[model samples]
Each structure stands twice: as structure tokens, then as C-alpha cells.
Target chain A: MSAAPVLCFDLGGTRMRAALLAPDGTRLAAVEAPTPAREGVGAVLDGLCALALRCRDTGVAPQAAGLCAPGPLDAPGGRMLAPPTLLGWRDVPVSALLGERLGLPVLLENDANAAAVGEQLYGAGQGAGSLVFVTVSTGIGGGVIVDGHVLRGRGGLAGEIGHMKIAEHSTDCACGAQGCFEALASGTALGWRAARVMRARKDGTPPPSGRDVIEAARRGERLARRLVAEHGRWLGRGFANLLHLYAPDVLVMGGGLANGFDLLEPAIRAEIARSAMPSYRETPLLSAALGDAAGLVGMAHIVRQSLPDLGRERKLG
Target chain B: MSAAPVLCFDLGGTRMRAALLAPDGTRLAAVEAPTPAREGVGAVLDGLCALALRCRDTGVAPQAAGLCAPGPLDAPGGRMLAPPTLLGWRDVPVSALLGERLGLPVLLENDANAAAVGEQLYGAGQGAGSLVFVTVSTGIGGGVIVDGHVLRGRGGLAGEIGHMKIAEHSTDCACGAQGCFEALASGTALGWRAARVMRARKDGTPPPSGRDVIEAARRGERLARRLVAEHGRWLGRGFANLLHLYAPDVLVMGGGLANGFDLLEPAIRAEIARSAMPSYRETPLLSAALGDAAGLVGMAHIVRQSLPDLGRERKLG
Candidate 1:
């Protein structure tokens, strides 16, 4: 019998990517489009409908569809529940709407979780049973896979590692929390710090982006270097907390900031090495292999696994 | 048919409790013994052997045995790895040794992880699909349960919540790290804080125990009350971190300090309400139902789940 194919969609705050995956996890076809999130969730659904129709026109019939989105999403309900990234997406019935529009089964997952599943099945965490995937882009996001299953708590809201408090008495978090790890180590936070340092300089140099901060640090800019080191230190602090709390065998770092992981790896690792339980020091920390496409591939797997009725019954275990 | 029985032991630094639970999760008999851990792990093992004999006397044939011990213990290898409480136990093959002595399969688990499994299957988390158990006693311990499986990291060393960094610029932890949750909000830390404040009194009053601090707070002792409140606030800070990271539907608070949870609930919830992502504001913070017995029962469930050759398997999912 021929293996079933699933449609995978990775939804970012601004862009959307679609892919077709065969049962053995082959990416057969792929395409991209703008999310149009500011036009509201209804318009975003309309865009997804058009994308799904376009993918269908490429001669591959999708047995099921999978969508990965910014979370606080309710995976069980296939709903996007109040994600900060998707404007006007409060309590949106994402999977149901997509399934109805496309006339196929659909599964919804947090993008980080999808990335984690992607890493575990086809990327850095291949063959690993327990893993934690951290995406450090504009913001820090994480997904935990334990005993070969995504650890989705009630309402499918588990794996919110970015918000874990790593710094004590530091800046306030966007979530109204004081000293959240995200407020210190996220890419946005790093950029914000760099810009603030530049503005405070007596030399009156213009502020820079997070990437510019890395470049400046490499070029021996004292404040920029300090900012990067501080971010790395906090990343290490957060990683230490994660090690203590999850103890996963593999920690996979991904997303845009990871492109220059060397800038942060030393200080980040130093903090973890100095702080985590000595016995757990052996756990490997590596860079994600799939990069941006991890979410799409991960969502493909989620569709296959969650919608067994679609008939691709390969055992993940 | 009568259900097979399993022998379970909860081994603490000072106390050890043993019980026999039927496959149906009924406790046939249970007893407590002094751990004498200061004498070293050998004496503790001997005590375990004696406890096995006691279980035999109850006429409940234990097909398998499980021990809930302080971790970095190896669950798969069944070894008592270096645990803080078991100072002398280093790479001891506890399960194999006990299996040989008792003529039954044996398994080992971190006490908190065991408690989490026990709670999920038989206590407050019984009906819940996923949960995180946090126990704030002399120290803090945490366990994560997802999809009815206990998450043991690569080396069976997951769930070390107490060691997570809480304060970036605070005191050192027992694990040779700075600003761990254990260093700031554990009962041990609470006692230390109370003692430090009392020592500064001109009246030469000795520092009180953690329980005394709680009592003093109840009696409106100004300094003690303030310190206790501060401890609760710090604890709340850690809880906020846990909520943000895991997003469990229920947060089960256990251990000795949880006895005062009623008094501390408001402050802890207030902190979490203020610090956590707005979406997680509603997660329940409740006291554990099983208390010390949670460890023993959790051990039984571990044996039932992990050792299929043993007859006590049906109780586990």
C-alpha cells in the first residue's frame, strides 16, 4: 500500500510556509506566503485556505493537515487561544476551520512543540527519546519531549520554557512578571539591551540591532561585548534551570540567534556547568539541524501521529 | 483472581517507610523505620532488607519491589547514584542487590518523581492527564508527569526542581551553586533566614526552627512573621517560574513546609497571578493529598509500570 501524505504549515508571526510530507517523512513540495495576521485571524484562515488549495494543485492529495502557530494554543481543541503574535486570534478555532475548509483532518500544535517533534524525528534529536528544543529568535520558545511524547499539559499549554524565571530581581517580563528568563535571554531582550547601551554611551553612537550587537562585540566594542556576555550568562542561568527541571538527554538550540551560537555558547555553557547538578553535566547541548523548516516538518509528524485514521500507522516508538 | 502485590519503600535521609500494595493499588500493610543514613548507605540497605522481611510477614507476596530515594539515582540501572541525603551512596547497584536478596525485580526512582506518579494515579492528580509536583520541605523537589509517563532524563536524573537557579545574586546552594530555589525558599532556607534575624537581637534569643518561625508568624511575632512572608514570596517567585515553564493544569505542593501552605497560599498565588503569563493565571495551587505516603505509593506504581515481568503490572497505564 502507498504511504499517506500530510500537509504541513508553519505559521510565524509574519510569514507562513507550507510543505507536503510522505509517510516516511519526505518533503515532496513546499511553498510560502505572508500571514496577514494584522488583518485578523479570519483573513489569516482565508490565506491558509488558498495556500492549502495551491498545495493540493501540485498533484499531492493531503490525507491530513497540520498547523503550527504561536501559542497559549489549545491543541486538544485545535484552537489558537490568545497568542500574542497573532493579532485578533483570540479563541480562534484553527484546526476545525482549516479542516472544514480543506475537507481533511487537521492537527494544531505550538510552533516550539512542532519544532521539538521535528528535531526528535528528523533533526538534531533523531533517535533520542527525551529532548528539549529551544528556539532563540525574536523571543525564546521551548518544547519538551519526554518518554517519546510531547508533554502537553491540560489545555495543551505545557512547554512554556521561555518564561521560566532565571534571573532574580531583574527587569520585568512582557507577561508582567519580574525577572523572567525571557526578559534577560531572548533575542528581543538582547537587542533591546544593545540599543539601550548604545543610547547611554557618552560617544553618542546610534543604537544597533541584535545582530549588530554581535558584530560589535566581535569588533571589540566594550558595551556591546558586555551585553552579549550578559545575555549568554542569563541563557546559561535559564538552561541550568531547565536542566534541573527537565533533565533531558539532549538540549537542541535553534532559530535565528543560533546562527551565531558561538558568540553565546561559551558563557551559556559556563553558567550551566557551574550551576547544574554535577551528575547532569553530561547531557549534550547541540544546535538544531532543521533550522527554520523544523516547524513544518514537525507539524507534518504531528498530523500523522494524531490522525491515525488517515492510515499512515508507522510506530513512532 | 487475587491481584499480585508489590513491595514499596520510601527512603528519606532520616526516615524510611515500607508498604505492600496489591495490583489494584490497595495497601495491604505498611510500616516505618529509622533510616540511620548518617551511618552510611550500607546500613540503609540492611534496613531495606529487614523491611522486605517485614512485608513477607504480612503474607503478601511481593512480586516486585520499588524504592523512592533521593536522586541522581539511575532508574534503568537501578543504582543509588550520589544523592545529597545519602552522602555515602555512590554508584551502588541497589536494585540488583535488593533483587538478589529479595528474589524479586526491583526498581529505583527519585522520591519526587515517584510522588508525582503516585499522585497522578492514586492521589490528587488521579484524573489529571499531566501534572508537575513540587514539594517544599527542608528542600524543594519536583516531578513532571506527561501522558501518564514519568520523565526521567537521559541518565534517569530528571526532576531536580530544587536546584534550579532562583536568585541570580543570592546565597549558594547545597549543590555548590549560587541562588538555587533551595537556597532561597526551602524550609531549610526559611529556618536559616529566621535564625539569622533572631541572632541579631540584643536579648540573645536563639534562632527558632522553621516550624517555630511559622508558629511565631501565626502568633504575630513581627520579625518572624516578616521573614516567613518573605520566604513565601520567594517560594511564590519560584512557583511563577514553574508555571511559566510547564503550564501544568494543577500545581501540587507537598513536603513538610506545605503544612503551612494554607497560610502561604494567598501570597504565593498573588505572586504567580502577578508574574506568570496572563493565560496561566488560573492554574490551581493545591496541597498534596498523600503526604509522606505519596513516595511509597509512587514507588509501587513505578515498579508496576517499569517492570512488566512482575505480576504487579496491571495497575499502571
Candidate 2:
């Protein structure tokens, strides 16, 4: 591994996380800011440019930088396509703009694919020959790794797990599909289930969010516990379906909802046991080790692999 | 490639087809007979021995034999584990028994996987680096080839595509799953749908079977045509799902139902166009080039690969 430090960014619609990661995989410096999603693509690019510059000012001239951002990315061209999550952002030449502003070679990767690479290299998926990483948040997204390389599919959309339909839910998904796994098992779905199953607490607290529902269940609330279990069951069903499809060596869960993994693992396992054949049932499902920072971990390698001459380019320039 | 000829068998519940294939992928001799399934394992072995002896009499001393059978197989142990399609077939030591009877080494393979290998090598999937082959017979089974090798899942059941759930259909599948692809769109399902829509022929013939239904549609029977289209729709949905999962270089359809490819291809493409990303949509859906002879084609290679020393043994013996 190169001794040179690398800049990493995990950009999402709601937030952007930037970090300077040393060769030791330690974050030397980190910063976060709300994404200027509604302010238009130009404003968002300016924000990112400023963020990268601020990190570069930390008395360290990073050799290269990597940005892990939301998809439908035109990865080969280093462009960000219009993703519904990013509002009106479309056809932004991300790497060129940021590289020009920061004076460093930059590599752009899909966020979910980056996270999978991160997990495979430095977290729960180490030593696994094949893995599928599913992140359950407001929407469920995924990344698949096969034979030690991230599977990008033909369009670099191989891990769009959220759009895979699981069952007919009472409501349709934002994807215009009925009964998507995300519409059933995402934090968004859990919040709706929690709201319907449990009334306001006697303490007169605010409305229950998905995290509140997890907390309520952790506190041994009966309806909340059952509702969480129900969520876990759906999660397990999706896992089973994926197991049948990929037969991955490991299935790792990340994102915010995975924080409640303790309450969900059993139900998930049970449903998987029920659905998957005995041969496919052995793949372990585990929580991601890197937590919130997982998305950018792969950026280091991405920069190195895609731009091996970064240091030479900078010196010559 | 060796100049050694190999014996191959494609065994099913209804029949057993055998052939001696030369080094250049040509059939030296071939024969077919009823499976003798109702006569128990002993009779089945005896019949297979007789068939092998007859083929051997044609002056082809084969290096080894390969058998492709219905699965839920203990492939490593060379045992058949009660596939629902084959009655009374449980824990049959196929390789050992057949090898002993024929006085040659034997290798066992799942029929669909073998067919996929056949297609990948000598049929529509030729030259494709990655392929997904679906066999639509009485049921839907599949084989996935990636990086030039068949993907055998954890227990060698990786390509059981028929069991994948589609949506809630009116009936349950033989696999005890509701709305399985087989339950909704297989030839068996088409037969039932055809029976429902059309009465017995005016010539006082019995209710039309699945093949009869296809024949009627080919002749432009209105209700049969509509029912066949519905089957095509479901097939398209399954194709879309597989595209998202595999993003294979080519998709090949084999088995009896693929005979109706002219009827199903349009709808399959339409659903795929609607559901798959543009890049994945480019993968061609083509009929398997080998037709009904595909199952045993891969067996020749399987025998060669698994028993590489068979030639030496034959010479020494």
C-alpha cells in the first residue's frame, strides 16, 4: 500500500462525509456538511469543492482522492447521472470538476459498490470469496462482490436491491413498483408499521421515528417488539431470496437500520432457514464492521488502482 | 481436447437417452429407452448397463461415462437425493453403480447444469464469457456460467431457478412454494391454463395437453394464443429478474417449451425492456441451438474433466 494519504468522500442526498485516510486505514481528519441538494447541481459541486479544499488544508497534500457517491453513476465517464435521491442533479462531470478544483487525481465510484469493496477489504467480508452487502435505510440499497471484485453489472446498477420486489405491500413503492423489498423492509416501512401498531406513550413524547420504534422495542414494549420482529422477518425473506440468487459466501448489513441488528438477527435467520435450501443456508449474515465510515474505505484502493500515475502526474505538472 | 470418446446419459423420470460422443463433439452412436423408474433402482441399473453394452458394441471403447440427472443431488458424494421429478429416486449411488456396470469411470452432473454447459460450449452461448441458460420443460430449471465455469452453489443447487417466487398465483408449486416461476409460467402451468380456456376437440378427443395447447396456438386458436401470451409475460418477468441478478453476456432458453420461442420471445423481450436497465437489456435472449440433445452434450466434457486419467487407465487395462 502507498504511504501517501488519500482524500475520501461519501456523498449522499442528506449529507456528505469527507475524510483524510492514512495508509494505516485511520482517518487523519474528517468533516461533514448537509448536502446542498435543493440548491442545484452547481451549488452542490461548489460545496464539495470547498469541502475537499478544507480537508486538503490540513497540512497534508494527499496524492489522490476518491469520491463515493449515489447512483445511477456513469462510472466509466466519471459522471453522475440524475438519481432521484439527489433531486435535480444530472449529468454532472464530477471527477473532472473536483480534480480541477483540488489539483489531485480523483476516482469516482458508486456509493453502494464502494461500501461493498470497503467491507470486503477491511470489515465483515474479509476472507469471504463472495459477498452481498445490503444497506437498510430510508431505502434499501446493495452491493455485490464476486471472486474478490465488486460486481457492477452491465450498467453499474447491479446492486439496486431496493427495486427488487419481495411481496405486495399495502402501498406501492416510490420506484413505481408494488411490493418492493425496500417498500417492505426499509426504515421507512418500519416507521409506518410502528406508527400503526403502537399509540402515543404516556410521557407525551413526539411522534415515533424508526429509531424510536427500535428503542421502544429494546425497552420491551410488546407491540413494538412484534412489529420489529415483523420487519426482521421481511428482511430475512429478502436475504433468503438473495441467497437463492447469489449463493454469496456472506451477507452483510450496513446503514442506519443495522444498528438494531440485535433485535432483528433472529427473525431474519428464522425466515432464511425456512426459505433457503440447506446448501445455501450456511452463508452468514453479519453487521458491517466499519459502520458509518464504510462507504469511503474502498476509495483508497479505487484511486490507487484507477490512477496509478497520480503522484507522477502531480510532480510533472 | 482428448481424442478419447466418452459415454453420456441424460436421465429423466420418463426416459433415458444415451450416446457415445467422439473427441470432436460428434455422436458415434445413440439410443433411447424408457427410464424403468417404476421397476425400482435395480431394474434401472440393469437397463442402463444394457444400453451401455449395446453402445459399446459399436467398436467405441469409451474412456469414461457421464450421467446428468435431475437434482437435489449430493454431487460430491455422487448420490441422488430424492428429486421430486424422479419417483423413488433417493440416495441412489449413481456414479458408482453405473461405473461398475459399464466397467468405466463415471461422473454425475445436474441435468440443467449439464445442458447449460452444452449450450455454453456448442449452442447459442458459444463464445459468450458469461451465460445464463434456462430450461423450460415440465418445470423451469437453470444453469449459470460465469468466468467460463458453471456456478455450483453451496450445495450444488445454485441454478434451481424454477423455485424462485414470482408473485401470488392461484396455485402452489410442487416445491411447496406459492407463486414460484414454475407455478406461474412453466409448461405444466401452461397446460393447466390451456385446459381451462379450451374444451376437448369437437372430434371427441380428450383435453389438450401442454404440447397440444402449443400446437393449437401455432394453428392460431384464439384462446390458446392468449393463454400462451400470458405464459410469455410471466417468462419475461422472470427474465427481467435474472437480468438484474446475473447481467450475463447471453441468455439461452432450452428444453421442450423453447420450441414455442417464436410465440414467447416478443413478450419476454417486452417485459425485459420495461424492467431491465438499458445496458442489461442488450443481452440477447436466444433459443438453445442444440435442441433436445443438449442434456448429454455437456456430459462428454464432464467425464473428460472429472476423470482425466481415464485414458491412461483404459490403455493400461
Q: Which candidate has the top score in lDDT?
A: 1
Pull out the clashing pairs in model 1: none
lDDT, model 2, position B74 = 71
lDDT of 1 by residue, A101-140 (tens): 8887678899999999999999999988889999887778
The two-chain DockQ for each candidate, comma-separated, is 0.70, 0.34
Could you give candidate 2's per-residue lDDT for residues A94-212 as a string of tens digits? 88888887877777888888898889889999988788999888888888877777776555656677766555344667765566778888988899877655444445555577787
Worst 10 residues of 1 chain A by lDDT: A308-317
List, residue by residue over B1-317, the lDDT tens digit for candidate 2.
56789999888888898899987678898888998888788888887887887788899798788888888787766788887766678888988888878888778888988888889888999998778899887888888877677777556666677766656444778766576777777888888777665454345455666677788889998877887888887888777777767778888998889889898788888877765556567888999999867878887876777675655655675
Candidate 1: clashing residue pairs, number = 0
The local lDDT score (0 to 100) that residue B38 gets in candidate 2 is 83
User: Model 1 segments beyond 4 Å from truth?
Assistant: A218-223, A309-317, B310-317
lDDT of the structure predicted as candidate 1:
0.81
Q: Please give the lDDT score for candidate 2.
A: 0.80
By TM-score, how accurate is candidate 1?
A: 0.92
